[model samples]
Each structure stands twice: as C-alpha cells, then as structure tokens.
Target: MSARMTDAEARERMDEITRPEKPFNRFRWTITVALLVLFFGTSLTVDISPSALLALPERTLFYLGLMFLPPDLSEVGRSFNAMVQSLGMAWIGTIIGAVLSFPLAFLAATNLASKPVVFAARQILNFFRAVPEIVFLILLLPITGLTPVTVALALGISSIGTLGKLSAEVIESIDPGPVEAAAATGGGRLQRIRWAVVPQVIPEIVALWLYRFEINIRNSAVAGAVGAGGIGTLLVREIQLLRNWATAGTALAVMVIVTLIVDTISGRVRRRIIRGPQRPVDIGADTLPPDADRDAGPDLPNDPGEAGPRTFAPI
Candidate 1:
C-alpha cells in the first residue's frame, strides 16, 4: 500500500490531519465580529477618534517631561511630610473599613445568616459600592471641611462594600466540617462563628484588609488632589495652579518612591499571612533501600512503626 499510494493521496491525508474540525464556526465568528462592531461603535460615540489617539503619545510626553527632567528638591521636606499624611489617611481608612466590614461580611454570608438578612446586607453593600468615593467626599466636605480626614472617611466608606463582599465569599468557602462539628456539639451561633468561622477566615480577611490598604494608599493621593491636604494636593497645585513644574516634579518623585516602598512591604506581609506555617516532611522506612541499615545506612522494614495521624499545632 505504501508503494502504491500516489503523492496526491499522502498530501491529502496530511492536510486532513492538520485541518481543524470546524475552522469557520459561524457562531464564534459572528460573536467576534459583533464585539468588534460594538467596541468601535461605542468608542466613536465617546469621541475617541483616530486623530485623538494619534496625538496621545505626544501629549503624554509633554507631561512626563514636566514631571521629571529636573525636579526641584527645595520642597523635598514638605513633600515628604505630605506623603506621610497620605499614608496616615490610607491606614486610618483601612482600619475603618476592616472594622465596619468584619460584621457585615457575616451577615451577608448565606451560611452565616438567614436569606433575608443576607439579601439586605448585600443590598447595603451594593449601595456603598455604587456610589463613588468622590461623591462621598463631596457630600462630607460640608461637614468635614475639605480635610484629609474627609478623604479617609470617603475611602473607608467606599472600602466597606468591597471588603464585605470579599470577606463573605471567604466565609462561604470555609470548611463545613468544622462548622458541622461545632453544631453537633451544641455550639450556638456565636460559638460556631467564633470557633469555626473566625479561625478559618481571619487570615484571609486580614490579607484582604492589607490589600485594601495598598489600594487606599493610591486612592488617598487622588482624593487629596480633589481639595484634601496631602501629596496629591501639592502635586496638582504645582502642576496646574502654580505652574511650578519643578515643584510638581519633586512631589511626584516623593509620592512614587513612598508608594513603592509601602506596596512592597504590604505585599510581603500579605503573602506571609496567606501562606501560613507549613508542615515538616518526614522520612518513612518503606521508601528506604534494602540492606541500607546493615551497611551503615537505612533499609525499609516490613513492620514500620505507626505514627498517629499528623496534626498541625501552632508554635
């Protein structure tokens, strides 16, 4: 058969093997084309034409030059102080969000609360998320008087929705075994939550709070630009109000350096929190080479001593 086959037949077989089963799926092609149409159609509606895109790089370069070519170091001390203030704002905001969200998360969790309560809690969280931090800041301005504290309050309120939603998810995904065992032992709702739920969720929840802190750090700057007193305010004032490019550059540099340091430290802590203590590995006789014990080495014995099931205990 090999010698009898024509070259055309072999080529045809090779082509068939390489070809896809459905090379031109009408549904997939239609969907892709529809998405493309929607993207371009919507982009056009928002006035994002080709001409604007073509000039974007030049416009960006103009600002980049203003920020970094020769930053003024005269205001380094003041910029550093403002950067510290932003950090404080972020820290306080995170604490507020963590405290407020910790309880609401339980309420929103289906396993932890009745359906009605969960639904209501979710609705409340949704309301918080739907409103932007800027809006909250604006509303609170009259009361808080355009201070960094107001920025912190806005950030905290905005964070509640996100933190609560995530914490609820973590709660829902916890081990049911512990919860069931607690209930079996006549553990009341509070007892189950305290023993089973809190233990399992605390680490992840803390990690979430840390991550939120990192986000809030960035957000604090933006909030400051909107009338609050922080590095962001300094940056904006220099760039737009005072037209002091050198001063703006100094503030921008300080903000970047401080933010990077904070993010690095926070990320390390979050990773360590998530990856808790690991179990130590042990050697077993079954896997050792035969005659190893007799030859100043170890051998796998037929009757290996039994060790009870391993359990993790905190140091």
Candidate 2:
C-alpha cells in the first residue's frame, strides 16, 4: 500500500494482478463469424461472380458516359416544377408529423403520463416506425388518387414514429428544476407540462422536425417514381421508358442541386435553433412565484414539504 515498493513487492503485485484467468474472446469471434456469414450469404443470394465484380467499374463508367455525354435541359422548367412539388410534399408531411407528434410525445413520456397511456402511445409510434413510407403511399394512392398530397400524408404518418420517440426522450431528459418549481407553486399536471416541459424541449423538437423534413424530401423523390408526382417520375421515365440520357441527366442534376440546397439551409436553421441566441435561455425569470421560495424557506435534502414527496429540485 506504500507509495514506493521494493522490487520483490512490485513483482508480488504484478503476479496478483495477472493471477485471474483471462476469458475467451467470444465477442470478437462472434462478430467475425457473423460478418463472414452475412458476406457469403449475400454474395450467394445475389449470385455475384469474380468476373462481374471486376467488370463493375467499367460498366459504371460506360453508363455515366451515356447519361452525361451532352446533358440536355429541354425540359428544365418541368424538372424545376416537379422539384417544387417534392418540396411541397416534404413540407406538408413535416408539418403534419410535427403537429401529431407533439401530443404523442407528452403521452409517451414516462415522467409525464401514466403506464397505460405511455404504453399505448409508444405502441402507436412503433407501428409507424415499423412500416415504410412507401406502403402508406400505396394505401393512400387509391383514396387520394396519385397526388403530392398522398405522398405528404404518407410521409407525415411515417414521421410520427421517429418524432414521437425522439420527442419523448427529449421530454424525459429535460431540466427537472422547472418541473419542481411548477409543482411547488401548486401547478397541476397540465400547467407543469406547459410552463416547465414545453419551453425546455421546444427548440430541440423543432430542430428534429427540420431534420425530418430533409428526410421526407428524399422520400418524396422515391414516392414520385411510384406515381406520386415529382422529379423522380420524370427522371425514371427519361431513363427507363424514353431512354433519353440527356433529359434524364438534366432531371437528375436538378434533383441533386435542389436537395443539396434544402439540406444546407435546414442544417443551418437547426444549428441556430439548438444554439439559440442564448444557450439555455431563462426568459422571464422574474415571473417565478416569489412566495414559493420565501414562505417555504430552505429545507433539508430529505424534506417532504409543500411540494409533497419532491422527486426533483433546481440544479
């Protein structure tokens, strides 16, 4: 235990440290075997041969040359309009999801809702997450009849799962101080959530919405290919049906450029929201109830006072 030890003592400590038997590297071996199995299984399933692998690069280059040799912009106006439609669908979907997910988040938060409510809300979110957005588009296609609105609705429903789940997590992880203060001031459950919970989580939730919008934009492109109405439909038609490489290239370029612009703007806005004008802003702190601190006084850590059986305190 001394700071300095004799050589014999050091040797004795080393032996003691190394005395336990080392366990087998089962985790490493398991990972290696699983990866091998997956690689071989996928290769067999896809029937990819050594010659095909070697020819992949050459084939890719040949295709690229065909598409972009003299990229045409004859239908540039149409591509631009379709891109706007895709943007519209994405925005509509994001708003719908944002609106729906907000309430579900509260219901799903363990700190806010009862066990039954939480369970039900979470199951709803899970079902949304489990199914792809394409499936929802398919279901809505018949009723809505192949419009951007249908894609928007599908994306909205799809967004609920992720938004709800993430928002719930954000709700649960908020500063407990605000909740405690609300309770101490005799605020009921709803008041506590409104005054305490919303302010803390709103910025993050909005940022998440923006991020989801970026995702929905991409999803819109895929939906368009399946007859939802966007640049995707045009791009696919030019390439597959018309075999017009120039037009296809133009459409593809427009889609990429537009998507990138949206992504860049959204990312900047999300950063601004997260890193607010004041990080962890305490807006209108003067409004806090004066009597709660004065009348109650400072209680011991274990005190169960006006805020009956206090679970959280200001940090």
Candidate 3:
C-alpha cells in the first residue's frame, strides 16, 4: 500500500527543484553603494558643472569653423612626408618590441617559469608599461636629439611591458597536453617550448604586434608634439606658432585618414589569424575503420625517402 503525498509537500518539493535559493550578497550591495559615493565625490572634487557642458557645442563649432574654413593646401606634400615618417617609426618600434618581448614572455609565464622568475619579469614589465611613450620620448630626446629614431625607441620600450604581459597570459592559457607529450618524448626545456608552445602562441603574438603597431602610430604623433619628427610636429608648428589653422586642419585630416586605413587592414589580418585556416570535415569519412591507415592514401608519399620525419629545432 502506497501513501499519497500532500499537495503542500508536493509544492514544496517542486519549489526546491525548480527555484533554488540564492544567498543574499550584502558585500556586493555595499561595494556598489561605495562606488556610487566615490563617483559623486570625484565629480565634486573636479568642480564639474552643467553650465560648462552646455557651452561645449558652441565652443567646438567655433574652433571647427576656424580650422576648416579655407582648407589650406600649402603643406600637403610636407604633411604626407611627415605621415610616412610616423608610419615608419611605428613599424620599426613594434618590431623591436616584438623581438624583445618574445623571450621575456616565457619567463613571466606561470606555467613555464618558477614563481620568483615570473614575479621578477612581471615587475620589470610593469616598470616599462607604467611610463608613457611621450615621457620616454622626452627622456631620449636629449640623447638622440629629436630624431624619428628617438620616437621609435620610446614607443618600442613602452610597448614591451604590455606585449610581454599579454604574451605571458597567452602562454599560460595553452593546453598542457602537448607540453606533457613533448616531455614524455625526452624533449629538453628549449625543445619542448619549440615543439609544444611556440606553434600555438606565435600567431597570437604576431597579431598583438600588429595591433600595437596601430597604437604606436598615434603615440608617434604625440611624440611629434615635442619635436620627435612626425606629423604632430607639423601640426604644432602650424597652429601654435604660425597660427595657420587651415594647415593644421589638413595635417589632422591626413592623420585621421592614414590611421583609419591602417586600422582597417590590421583588423582584417587579425581576424584571419585568429580564425585560422578552415577545412571542411566529412562525417561519413569520420566513420571509417579505426585501424585504417589514413596516411597511406595515394596522395601521401609512399616511400620513406620521399618524406623524412619532421624535426623541430630548439629556440
């Protein structure tokens, strides 16, 4: 003989299954309130007012009118040359940073290096990352004497911190199976990294380098404000000294157009790198016998002499 469950008991069991109880997060609410208070406090400290914001549109329009009314065509050649220099500086800087960061990334990676090594490498990267490219340019200007080379060096050194940290994170997130397999096959430290890690991380690292190159172009313009040789130098000279607003506007337009073009190209390349090569998979083919020699097809090399075993050199 079975007993029937009461309606209240059934409802209680259904509630337990369907709607699980959640804990009350007092700390989360407290933090949200604290953040709200801090935001208002900072706004008050900065003396922000609605009246100033209300006047912004009129002021901006006035400046825009001054800049683009006649649209000076006098310095078009000079602006183009300076823009090219900026691109060169950015490209060279990114290359230098990529070269320097590649090895340091392994040291900062937790999966690859000891705690002390990771900590030390991260601290070094942080120091470089904390300093802005403009500051680096300012310091190097005295030694390098206001050349594009100085701007390149500044951007390169500043880029190392961010690049190394991102690369270390990428290295740490890779699957551990390949690394374990490499070790099982008696590969040494460098050999394991070459065979198991470099192939996985190199594409992402190269994409990061291209992304940084786009950023460095803008930074190079900023460096030009301090006479480090770029379109920015032309801009400052025209607007601040000569009071040639139209020329300055032309330079600004050139900067914007070049940056947009580079960004578009780099973005497409990055997406391609991330997505990788696509191969169509056949479900029917996948159901073939497990013992089938898939590599023994006519398309594959039949003789050992035709296809030697692949080998990877240590980095």
Q: Would you estimate the TM-scores of all the predictions? A: 0.80, 0.80, 0.76
Model 3 — which ten-residue stretch has the worst lDDT?
Answer: 301-310
Candidate 2's error at 295, in angstroms?
14
- The segments of candidate 3 whose C-alpha lies over 4 angstroms from its true place after superposition are 1-55, 278-315
Quote the RMSD, in angstroms, for model 1: 9.9
Between candidates 1 and 3, the one scoring higher on lDDT is 1
Clashes of each: 2, 0, 0
Candidate 3, overall lDDT? Answer: 0.80
Cα-based lDDT for every prediction: 0.82, 0.82, 0.80
- In candidate 3, how many Å is residue 127 off? 1.4
RMSD of each candidate?
9.9, 8.1, 8.9
The deviation in Å at residue 177 for candidate 1 is: 2.6
lDDT of prediction 1: 0.82
Task: Give the Å error, residue 293, model 2.
Answer: 10
Off by over 4 Å in 1: 6-9, 12-31, 48-54, 278-315
